[model samples]
Each structure stands twice: as structure tokens, then as C-alpha cells.
Target: MKAVQVSGYGGLEKLELVETPVPKPEKGEVLVKVKACAINNTEIWMREGAYGTGSNSGWRPEGIKFPRIPGSDITGEIVQCGSEEDRLLIGKDVVLFPFTSSGERGNEHIAEDMSFIGSEYDGGYAEYVVWPADLCFDMPLKTYSDSAAFSVSGLTAWHMARQVDIQPGETVMVTGANGGVGSLNIQIASKVFGAKVIAITGDLKNEEQLKALGAAEVLSYKSTRLQEEILECNGGPVDTVLDVVGDALLAVSLKVLKKGGKFCTSGSAGGQITQLDLRILYLKHITMYGSVLGTRAEFKELLQEVSNGKIQPVIDKFFPLEKAREAQDYFKQHGKTGKVILLPKTGDDLQI
Candidate 1:
């Protein structure tokens, strides 16, 4: 089988296309013939070695050994099943749940031992990959690329919205609202839950598109007096803020929230380290949540929404598996609205 391997932490030069043996499914696992996988900020952060302690050097998780295949948003068909009871799943198209459990599946909040797909072990970026059957859920979408596109990004956005529990008629502000997760957050918050959505972005070109996606207002992140603009445009402070861009913006976002407002963050796209005013936290009695991946229950709800066509995957670009490096570069440079997809080349896998 052919796979894209990140031999070490570095730039795009670290990604290598190589021939490897086909993996056999172990007990409780299944072998998926990957048809499509989406690239995400997680892959870029891991490639640049940004997830660990230091800015330039650190580990992602316990199993982030080098020479790893990196891609987690996977959608494929099960060609082989390890358990006899799971034999019925053969030929089923499924998207991976992404998280490695800590025994308790339902309570992901307390499951601190949880790990992820691309970081914890070899992931999709291959012709075929093996995973525990429990993590695979059926994807009823028309194409593999479409299913893969929504897996991780949609799940993260949904989980963040749930964390804040956006109620109907409530106001929520989504930062970086033009990116994959942020764009989806706009849709889920306003379209699904009937919340008044306020989208924040550095790109003004997305204003009309975002409003069409259900944003009540679009504020510029580059505005000199952004805090005032948000307050003025929304007529008051927002009830919740869904922020993915951290750094100084984190503190500024905190300033724009109404008293007792809820804030939830899942990504740190704009540098991780940032300062916050302790007074702003306590004075307003604000509630903040640091979210990662969603629980199984949230995943199920997201899946149902996807099945019902309530939520749609927005794709920015597509690249062949051989051009994985180029895809990553494009995402870092030009990707803003939605996911970037990678497709396996014809007969790219070795018949070992």
C-alpha cells in the first residue's frame, strides 16, 4: 500500500510518498480502503511540531512517534473485518470517530486519557488503514470526499456549539468565521438552533456569504476599534463567543462579551500563547470552556444532522494523495472558507 509519511517534524519537505505493506485487521479492528481524506489545521500544527510544550519543539500525544502517517478526517469503505460479528460492516462506507477512548465512551469530558487519530497513531493518508471497529460509523453521503470533508471539522464545530449550548434567540459570536470550523459554526448556530449569529473575520469578502449562512452580522477582526464595532453593530454584547483564533484576539473577544456570557474555544490558529485579564474573567462572571473533540453522543447528533441534510460540507480545494505537500501549502496560504480534500490516485497502493 502507498502512504504519505511524515518522517520528522519540519516543513512540507517532511512529507514523503512511499510504498508500504497492506495492514491486516486485528481483533476488534477493521481494515478500511481509504477513498478520501481531508486536510486540517491539526495536520499542519503536527507537521510543524506546534502541539507540544515549546513553540518549535514538542510532542503531540503519547504515540506521536516519527515516520507516522498523518490524516484523521477519513472516509472509506471497510474491506475486511477482524471480528466475526463485525463481518456485516464489510463494504460499509464509514467515517472515523477520531478520538481514542479511555474506557468510558459516554463521558468524554472526564476522559482525559483520550487521544486522536492522526496524532496518536498512523492515520488515513494511506491506501488502507486499520482501526477499532467501535470508532467507525456508517457514512450515508454520496461520495467519499464529501463524507471525509465534514468528519472532523463538522464534529469540532458542533461540539463547540454544544459546549456553549447556544439557545434559540440567543446571540453568539464566531471568530475566524470564514474558516472550516468557524464557517460551520455559523451554520449550526443560526440555521440549526435559531440563534442570532455574529461572525468575526479578517476577510470582508466573506460578509455576504456569511450572512447567507445565517449570520446576523459580520464584524471585521482587523477593525481598529473592533470591540466598539461589535458592540455597536450587535446593539449590545453577545451572549456567547465561539473563538478558534486565539492570541491577543482571545482577550479582545472576552471584552466584547455580555455579562455572564459563555465562551468556548477549540483551536488556536493564531498562535497559542496569549494573555488574559483576570478582572475581565471574574468581573463579568463569564464562563469559559476549552474543547477538543466531541463525545460519541454529540457525534451521533451531528451524524443525524448530516444525514438529514441539515448541515452541508463546504470544500475549498482537492488534491491527489501524491500532492499532499502542495495541498498543505495551499491550505496554509489560501484556504479560508472550507475543507481541503485529498483523493487516492488510481492504483497508488502496492499489491503486496
Candidate 2:
């Protein structure tokens, strides 16, 4: 089988399309014929070698398995399993949870023996990958490959919303609302979760896109007086702020929150290191929480939501597996309102 591999992390150029053996499932594992893989910011940073430094380098709980295939967000069908206990997923369609050995991104702390797919382990950039049978779910809907690819991103957003135990009718602000997770958050918050949704983004091109997904209002970051605009939307304090862009925007998010509102962050697309004064935490008594991806159970729960049509995963485009390198570059250079999917078996007459 052909897959994307990199001898060392550096840039898009480091990723190469190469031939590799199709892996067989081990004990308690199921082999999945990966039909689709989605690109996230985590892949972007890792490809650029940003996570190859400092504490991050130490957090390779899954260890530095070199010639790595970096794709974590994947969806596909199972073809083989080790045993009946491991056979729950044979022929079932599903998406994987982003929770891996280093807690998805090898962020602060990851044990030396554990890691996630696409990060420390070979991922779904190829025609086939073997998932631990326990990690796979049954994709039970009519949506295409891209929509089912929301398992990780959707679950992360769901977990973030649940952190504060959000209440219906409460005002919620979502940053990066045009991105995959951001777009799903808007849909879940407004339609399923029952919160009033306000999106913060500068993608004026996607304002209409966001509205169709159920955003009550869309605010551009480039516009002057965004804080003032947010104030008008909720008339005062917002109940929750879900941030995708951290660092510079974090301080403003604190100001936007109501006296006791909570702030939940799932991404640091701007930069992981947040440089803000801790004094604000004392003054406002604000609750700040960070979601590292989601637990196994949460991924299953998110899949159920998609199956029931409560949430939808927006797809941007699909690329063939031979050009996984080009696909990663396209994710960075081309604009996206949702996820970019890579099909491993496209037009190759390959099947599980």
C-alpha cells in the first residue's frame, strides 16, 4: 500500500508519498481500510516540526516512531479483527477519536509508551490502518466520507461545550467559526445544544456559510470595535467563550465573558503559548478549562449525534492518496470553511 511518510519533520516537503506494507491487526485490534482522513491544525504544526521541540519532544508517550505517517482524523471501514472480542468493528464504518498517546498533540505531558495516530504512530494516510477494535465506531448515517470524519473534531467541540455545562439560551462565542471544529460548534450550540451562537471570524467569504450552519450572528476579527459588537449581540455578558485562536485574543475573550462565565479552549492555532496576566483569573473569578481532544466514550457519543442528524461535518474537498503531500500543502495554502479529506483507495480498485 502507498502512504505518506517523513523521515524527519520539517515542512510540507518532508512528507513523501511512498509504498508501505499493509499492516495486519494485532491482539485486540481491527484492521480498517481507511477511506478518508481529515487534516487538522495538529498535523500542520507537526509537519512543520513545531511540536518537535522542548517539552513536546519529551512527551512522545508513543515515542518517536520515525518515517512517520501523520494523519490522526480518519474514517473508514473494518475488514479484519483479531478475535470475537476484537471483532465488533469488522465491516463497520467509523471515525477515530483524536485522543492519542501524547494526549493528541504531545502537548504538556505524554507517557513514554503511548501516542495517537498521525502523531507518534503511522496513521490513515494510506490505503489501510489497523485500529484497536475498541477505538472504532459504527458510522450509522447517509452522509458521505467527509461528514463521518467529524468524529474527532466534533467530539472535541462537544467536550468543550460540556466543560461548563452550557445552558440553553445562554450566549456563546466561538472563534475560528469557519474551520471544521468551529463550524460544528456553531451547529451544535445553536441547533442541538440550544445556545445562542455568535461566530468570531474574519472569513467574510464564509459569513453566509456560517449563517446556514445556524450562527445567530457573525463578527469579523478584522473589523474595528468587535468587542463592542459582541457586547451588542448578548447585550452584556456572554455565558461562554470557546476559543480556537489563543494568545492575543485570549485577553479580549476574558473581557467578553460575563462576570462568572467560563472560557473553554480547544486549539491554539495562533500559538500554543498563552502570554496573559494571571491577575485576571483572580479579579473575575472566571473558570478557564482546556480540552485535550476527547475520551473514547465521548467519540462514540459524538458519532451517535451525527448518526441522528443532530450535527453535520462540513467537508471542503477530497484528494487521492498518491498526493497526500500535496493534500497537506493544499490544506495550508488553499482556504477552507471545513475539513479537507484524503481518500486512500480512490480510483485504484482497492477495497478492504
Candidate 3:
């Protein structure tokens, strides 16, 4: 088997494409022949050795090992399963949940001992992977690209919307609105969750595209008095703010949030640390939430919406598995409108 491994995080050179042994399924596990996987901001963090530290790495609940095959958003087919009872799953197209926890079924994301696919263990940067059979869900109506696109970004956005409890007719603000999670967050908030969406980005080149995705308005940080502009456009302060940019906009977000409004954050692509005036929390009665990936229930709900055609995962570009290093570089260097996908060199053509 050929896979891309992060030999020891640092630069693009760390991601080396090498030959490795194919892993077989253990009891209650399933082997998936990789079809497609998506590049995520998390992967960049992994490549930089951002997580798994003593004091700073809260994202990786489990310690990481070297030479890790790093890819979490996956969609593939079950080629083999440990138990014959589950053998019917072979040849079934599915998406893996990307967690190593058992949390009373639905609330797995918040489990105390939770771990992830790409970071905690070997992931889908290869032609094959082995995951718990129970964590795999059948992909009913999506292509391999669609499934991979929706894997992490969709699940994370769904959880953020739920955390903020976005409502119909209420204004919801989404930061980093052109990135994978941010773009999907905009769609779920307005199209599925029914909130009036406000998108914030550094550049408004994607304004028309965003408005078509249900964003009522798009604001750029380059504008003077960003907080004031947001307030003026929405008629007043917004009811909720979904931030993926983290520190870069956290302060501005607080200024635009209405009294008692909820702020839900799922990523810190800009930088994790930010300045916060403690007075705002008590004075405005604002509620803030820091979320990561979502639970199984949330993932299923997201999938249901996709299956029903209520939401669509956007793909910015595709790269062959061997070009993963270039994919990661592009993901970090460019501001794309959607998720970036990587296809296995298994002879399948790119499917729309």
C-alpha cells in the first residue's frame, strides 16, 4: 500500500509518499478501500506539530505518534469486515465518523477519552484504512467526492449551528465565510436551520457566491469600522456569530453580537490566541461556545440533510493522492470557496 505520512511535522517536506503494509481489520472492524478524502485546516495544524503538546494542544485528547498518515475527512467502500454478519457491508459505500470514542452512541464528540482519525491514528492518506464498523455509515445518494467533502466540514458546521441554536428570522453571522467550514456553516444556518445569514471574510470576491448560498449580506474586514458596518447592515446587532477564523475576528464579533447572543466557534485558522475584554462577557450577558467535531447524532442529521438535497458540500479542487503535499500547501496558501478533495490512484475518474 502507498500512503502519505507526516514523517515528523515541520514543513511540506515532512509529508512523504511512501510504501506501507495494508492494514487488515480486527474483530468488529472494517477495512475501507479509500476512494476520496478531503484536506482540512486540521491537517495543516497536524503537519506543523501544532497539536499534542503539553500545555497548548487541547484538540488532540490523545498523544500523537510520528510518521502518521494524516487525513480525517474520508469516503470509501467497505472491502472487508471482521465478522461474517457484517460482511454484507462489503462493497457498500460509506463515510467514517473519524472518532475513537464510545459515548452513549450520540454524544461521542464530547466523550472524555475521545480521539480522532488522522491525528490519533493512521487515516485515509492511503489506498486503504481500517476503522470500527459501528462508526461507518452508508452513503445513500452522494458520490465519493460529495461524501468526502461533507465528512468533517459538514459535521462541524452542524454542531456549531446547533450550539448557537440558530433560529428562523434571526440573524446569524459566519466568519471566514469562504472557507470549507465557514461556507457550509452559512448554508446550514440559512438553508437548513432557517437563520438570516451574514457572512464575514477578509475578501468579498465570493460575495455573489455566498449570497446565492443563503447569506443575506457579506462584509469584509478591510472595511472601516467593521463592527459598525455589520450592525448597520443587519439593522442592529446579530443574534449569533459562528466564527471559524478565531482570534482575528473574535473581538469584532463580540462588538456585533446582540445582548445575550450566542457565539459558537469551531476553528482558529487565523490563530488560536486572542485578546478578550472580560467586561463584555458580564456586561452583555453573552454566551460563548468552543466546539470541535460533532456527535454521531449530529453527523447523521447532517447526512440526512445532504441525502434529502437540502444542503450541498462545496468542493474547491481535487488532487491525486500522490500530490497531497501540494494539496496542503494550496489549502493554506489560497482562500478557497469550499473543501479540497484528494482521490486515490485506484483508477476512478473524478466524479462531480
Candidate 4:
């Protein structure tokens, strides 16, 4: 099997494409012939040794094992399975959640004893990946692999935008407006929920693209006047602010919210620790929440949205399994706007 692996925690250069042994499913597991795998900021953070701190890892679990194959979001065909019921999924195309939990430790989900495909175990950055049946979901439709590959980012966006309990006619602002999650969020909020969407793009180049996705307004944050521009465009009050790019943007985004508005964030490419003032929250009566990959049920609802064509994945590019490093580099350099995909050695005509 040809796969991507890293010698240790470092940069993109650490990724190695090599012929590793193909893995077979265990008693309760299944093997997937990966059609497409997608990258997330979580992989980047985990790879740079930025995940899991002092007994608390953000997504990588408490004792994250490394020298890892880094990719989580996946879309593929089932080649084999452990049980009769599980094997029923074989030959079927599917999309997966990648994260699994067998139990709960109070309010948060404690990862069960199972592996988190690309993070803890060898993921789909290879010709084949092995995992249990509990982690997989049959893809509902025929679509581009990159589109199906957006499971993680798309579902995360749905969870974030839906958190405000967006009511039609309400207004919401989305940062990283053309980004994987942000783009889907824009369409989901506007097209499905009928919310007025205000989107923030780092580049002025994406303004029209944002608007086409139903953003009521698109502001490029470069002019140093984005914070005010957003408030002005809404003409008065904005209901929710979704921040995908953290750092300065978080605090700035909060400032643009209407009284009693909600703030939601999922990624922090702008640097992990951003400052936020607590007093302002009290004065304006604001609500804030951190978002991550959705729960199983939430992902189901999102998939329904996908099936209904209420939202669609925006893929910036795809890569062959061997070009994993280039894919990672392209994403880090902002050379790609949406999800980057990795396909297996199965010799499919599918291009990233």
C-alpha cells in the first residue's frame, strides 16, 4: 500500500510517501478502499505538535500517538467488513465522521477505546484504511469526491451556524467566507435557514464569489475598516457571528455583533491563543461557544441538507496520494480556498 507518513512532529517536509503494508480489518472492523480523503486544520495543529496540552488535547485525545498518517475527512468505497450487517456496506460508497466515542465522561465525549482513523490510526492518506463499522456513513448521493470529502468541515460549519439557532430573517456573519466551512455555512444559513448572511473574506478577490453564495454582504478585512463595514452593511443589528479565522478576528468579530448576539468559532489559523474581553460580553449580553466536528446525529441532519441540495461542498483542489506534502503545503500557503483531497492507489480515474 502506498501511504503518507511523518517521521516526527514538524512541518510539511516531514511527510513521506512510501509503500506501507496494506492493513486488514480486525474482528469488528472494516476496510475501505479510499476514494478521497480531506485535510483539516486539526491535522496541521496535531502535526506541528500543537494538539493535546498538559493532559488535554484539543482533538488528538490525551495520549496522542504520532509518526501518524494525517488525514481524517474521508469518502470511499467499502471493500470488506467484519460482520454480515457490516459487510452489507461493502461495495457501497460512503463518507465518514472520522471521530468516534464509545462513552461519555460528563459533558464532553471521551473517546472510546477505538481509534480515530487518521489521527490515532493510519488514516486514508493511503491506498486503504481499516476501521470499525460504527464510524462510517453511506454517502447519500453521487458527487465529486472532493464534495463528498468535505464531511468534516461541512458538518463543523453546520454545527456552528446552527448553534445560534438561526431563525429565518435573522442575520449572521461568517469569517473565512470562502473557506471550506465558511462557504458551506454561507449557503446553509442563507439558502436553508433564510438568514441574512454577512461574510468576511481575507481577500477582496472573493467578494463576488461570497455574494453569489447568498451572502448579503461580503467585506474584505484588508481595508482596516472591516469591523465597521460589517456593522454598517447589516444596517443595524446582526444576529450571529461565525469566526473560522481566530486571533485578532475573534475580538474584532465580537465587536461587530448586535446586542445579545451569538459568537461561534471552530478554527484558529491566525494563531491559537487570541484575546477576548469578558466585560464586553456582560455589557452587551453576548453568548459565545466553541465549535468542532458535529455529533453523529448532527452530522445526519447536515447530510440531509446535502441530500436536499440546500448546501454543497466547495472543493478547491485534489491531490494524488503521493503528493500529500504538496497538498498540505498548498493549504498552508492559502493556495487553495476549499478542501484538499487525497485518493488511494486503487487506480481510479477520479482526480483529487
Using lDDT, give the best candidate's number. 3
In the predicted model 4, the residue pairs found to clash are 52-57
lDDT of 4 by residue, 239-325 (tens): 898888888587777787888989988887776786778888999899988887666777778888788777766777877888888
Worst window of 10 by summed lDDT in candidate 2: 102-111
Model 3, global lDDT: 0.86
| lDDT for position 298 in model 3 | 86
Which residues of candidate 3, in runs, are more than 4 Å off?
A: 52-62, 347-352
RMSD of each: 2.1, 3.4, 2.9, 3.2
Error of 4 at 325 (Å): 0.7
For residue 223, give model 4's deviation from the true position in Å: 1.5
Error of 3 at 96 (Å): 0.9
- Which structure among the candidates has the greatest TM-score? 3
Candidate 3 per-residue C-alpha lDDT over 1-352 given as tens digits, one digit per residue, 9 for 90 to 100: 8899987758999999998878888899998989999999887787785765543443555456777898999899888898888888989999988788767776788888788888877899999999999989988465898878887888899998888788889999999898889989989999997989989877788889889888999999778889888999999999999998888889989988889999998888877888899899889999999888888888889999989888877888999999998899888864578888999875343211
Model 2 root-mean-square deviation: 3.4
Candidates in order have lDDT scores of 0.84, 0.75, 0.86, 0.76
Candidate 2, 1-352: lDDT as tens digits: 8888866657777888887777878888788778778877777677665655633541253335568777777777788887778665666876665444434432312334456677766787878887777667666565437555586578778778777787889999999888878988898888877999889887678888898898989998877788898999779878899888887578778888887889999888766787777778778888999775656656666777777878877888788877777777777652478888887763346544
> Over 4 Å off in model 1, which ranges?
53-63, 346-352
Number of the candidate with higher TM-score, 1 or 2:
1
Worst 10 residues of 4 by lDDT: 105-114
Per-residue lDDT of model 1, residues 1-352, tens digit only: 7899998878899999998888898899998888999998998888787877334332233535778888999999888888899999998999998877675656763465666677667888988889999989989488888888777788889888888888999999999888888888999999899999889888888789888878889988888989998888888898999988988478778988999999899888886998788899899999999886688888889888888887777788899999999999988873267788989863634452
Model 1 lDDT, residue 213, Cα: 79
